[model samples]
Target: MSQSTAKAAAADASASAALRARSEVARLISYIVIGSGAAFLSLRASTLPTSRWEPLGAGSFPELVFGVLAVLCLTAAVRAVIDIRKAGGANRLGTSFAKWLVARRYSFALFGLLVVYLALLPLGGFSLTTFVFLLIAQLMIAGISKKTLIQSLIAAMIFSVGLNMLFAEVFNVFLPRGVLFAG
Candidate 1:
């Protein structure tokens, strides 16, 4: 092969290896996080109160589910660790993590929006809070333009107000009313 072609091929291989290493590291992180959460829940579930009358206690189901989840997470974490070690032990973890943050910037923004939406739900009211959040999130993702703005507003109104009305009137399930709208 030509020298230039051979160098290009080597570069491609290096890039592929780096991508693989990053993926394994990300998997390891996810497994660790999920495992910790599962373990905590399992422990909490164990201390829950049981029922006297019924054969199965209130905590029985939760305990079983969380225990199983914890075990599965542990198993997955071990496998991820093995993969990471084989891929050279996450030496580039910081680099991969920084790249991940940049790549998923929009996802982080959406999560932030969700947190705000939930926090303001009680105070602002469900419909209003949801409507504003939806409109903003949609516009943030889809970008602002004349057509998109109108469409997103329509969509936000329909989903926010329609769901509230449907749940309250049709399903006879009332959502939490905002303190502002309580009176």
Candidate 2:
């Protein structure tokens, strides 16, 4: 066999392997449809008790929003299934176990970041915690760049201070201030 032919065969094998690693489209479609139906039913069946603020008695807006989301999810699921069928196994599309594995690989780091940030929040206050979290997040996701590292740290400080003031003063939403301000 010629070198070109061998390279072509190798490429085809790799493509096939990648396709096999992907999730089944039909299963994804079924799950999405069932999940949306359940969400729709739950929202529709939810009862809101009488409250002075709600003249029509709450649960009205939530149910409407949920119904809309259900319709959207259902439509998306149907379209995905149809597209996959049209592709005739040429395209591996849908959220499957393989995709979940890939997503988890990327997202697990976020869980750790959240844990550290929350753990430090009470001890370091919002500014310090925000700075550390933002820096770590930026570095981890994008890799360390001197400019990006400095910018993210500064931006975190600005955002945390501004948002903290806005919530505490303007909205009267008390955020944890730690023991720094107590003394």
Candidate 3:
């Protein structure tokens, strides 16, 4: 083949590979989210008590919600599988997952921060926990710098304290005060 033809062919191959990688990643994410969410919802719905006293019963809402969610998830999973097949199957799923992980390391780190924030919420209280979570998350996402640090601190304070005050005073809703700070 000529040099120009060879270059064009290589470019086409590269584009095709990228497309396939993206398709595989989409399929994997869809499968994980929809499948897991459906299962979780189903379990949660099952745990809700069925009572004859109430017209619809306590489990009615949860059961309905879970049923709908399961149907939607099934549809999405089927679609994802079809897309994966069209993109040449999951032969490169591992490679695609690795590349996606590397590319989204920061996102994964932020998710970890969120998990920590949730775990500490009851212990540290809403205001304090939210402030710390926001500060750390903002710094990690926006990078550390004098100006960004100041901005993050201000934003965290405004969001945590300001929102807490609003909820407590205006909305008449009290957030957790934690064992240490509870009065």
Candidate 4:
């Protein structure tokens, strides 16, 4: 394999081992969140009586989503445990996991951006949030460039406006407009 590829593989192995060594704590946390979410939804569902069109009433959607999330978390816990068990031996992962870790660097930035977007939605409108998110994302991956910044800002504006219009006008869904809407 290539030198970079080998280095990535080594990095992945080390990261996986480190993550696995702490799997028990991670698994416990996942179990708590997933279990609580699932149970809350389940209880909500039980409190609602069956309807003509929908059997589970208002609780069905949240319950279904929570149940699926719980199952996925449970699966993650199982895999983490398995990885921890097999980490010592020679049975290591190939390039797939290594490449995934590399790609996750960008994905994590996107995740942080989303968190900020959601948090700031109540303070600033979608347009402002999108502008900041795009600028930061572009800066993180490829260093600052005037052209890139302009393009990103324009794209962010279009996306934010388009999505806002679609959700508010077409879908009739309410989005947080922040203090701007109140004034």
Candidate 5:
């Protein structure tokens, strides 16, 4: 083969290898996230209160939902494992995982925001806390723009106050009234 042809072939091989490495890392992260989420949801559903009046009880719907989620998660994990095996099991994942995390820093930032939102909920009240969380999350995910900012504000208001009112009036479910606002 010509020297140029050999160099071109080498470059193509390098690019393909990089792509495969990224795909494997992505699959590993997905498997971990789905598996952990399923476990958490299942445990949370188990803690829900059961009603004596209903055969299935209050916990029934949550349990059913979480059960379905768990099944889907398991299915995805199995598929990932199969794919990994087919790709010769690239098991040296530590460096790739770190690179993936750095590449997707926004995801970790959003997760931190969610944790902060949960922690501040009781102290800030549902309406205020949810409004702020929605606004910030929307901005982070969608990026900043005049139109987006306006829409984000409206959406945040609707989700926070409107949903709260709907739940309290229609469903008769009262959301938490923060310690600051509690009568």
Candidate 6:
């Protein structure tokens, strides 16, 4: 094989090893939870009132969406299970998990930031939350420097506040308002 191809093959082989069992297990668990949640939502959506003029109920779209989501999640769980099996078992899970975390420290940090940003959105409003998230995420990616910080701030403000205004004025779609900010 060519040099790059051989390197890729080696990487793939390493990726397919038992080191990934922990991540696969995590994926499996998340898929199961998401699938169950979607199934529950679908069940709830089925009870929405139907109008006589329309063939479908008001909840029909939601039901279809949630049902599809549940099915997809289940499929993903199956794939995760297959991956877990291929990666061996729980024997090396503990040892390999630390290695995986160390190797993906930056990814995990960004993921954690995303989760926090999402969780805080309702409380902070779309404008403030989006701006903060954009600034921090950009800084994390670009590294901290005075020029980059200012640039990130400006970009974040433009996108966040500008988008909020565009949606409110042009599109007539009002974003979620935070309790902290009284419009």
lDDT of 4 by residue, 98-147 (tens): 54456578887789888987898888877667667776877777777898
Model 1 Cα shift for residue 12 (angstroms):
4.4
- Each candidate structure's TM-score, on Cα atoms with residue i matched to residue i, is 0.69, 0.47, 0.64, 0.46, 0.56, 0.54
Instruction: Please identify model 2 stretches exceeding 4 Å from their true place.
Output: 1-104, 179-183
lDDT of 5 by residue, 8-103 (tens): 999998777766766776776786787778678877877888887877877677777777877877787777667666765456567666776797
Backbone clashes, candidate 6: 0
Model 4 residue 84 lDDT score: 50
What tens digits encode model 2's per-residue C-alpha lDDT throughout 147-183? 8788777777777887888888899997787766545
The local distance difference test score of model 2 is: 0.70
For every candidate structure, what is the RMSD over all alpha carbons to the true structure, in angstroms? 4.1, 7.0, 5.0, 8.1, 8.0, 6.4
Cα error, residue 145 of model 2, in Å, equals: 2.0
Q: Which residue pairs show collisions in model 6? A: none
Query: What local distance difference test score does each model get?
Result: 0.87, 0.70, 0.83, 0.70, 0.84, 0.87
Better of 4 and 5 by TM-score: 5
lDDT of 3: 0.83
Evaluated with TM-score, which candidate comes out highest?
A: 1
For candidate 6, give the lDDT of residue 120.
89
Off by more than 4 A, model 4: 1-103, 165-174
Sort order, TM-score high to low: 1, 3, 5, 6, 2, 4
In the range 138-176, model 6's lDDT, one tens digit per residue, is 999999999999999999999999999999999999998
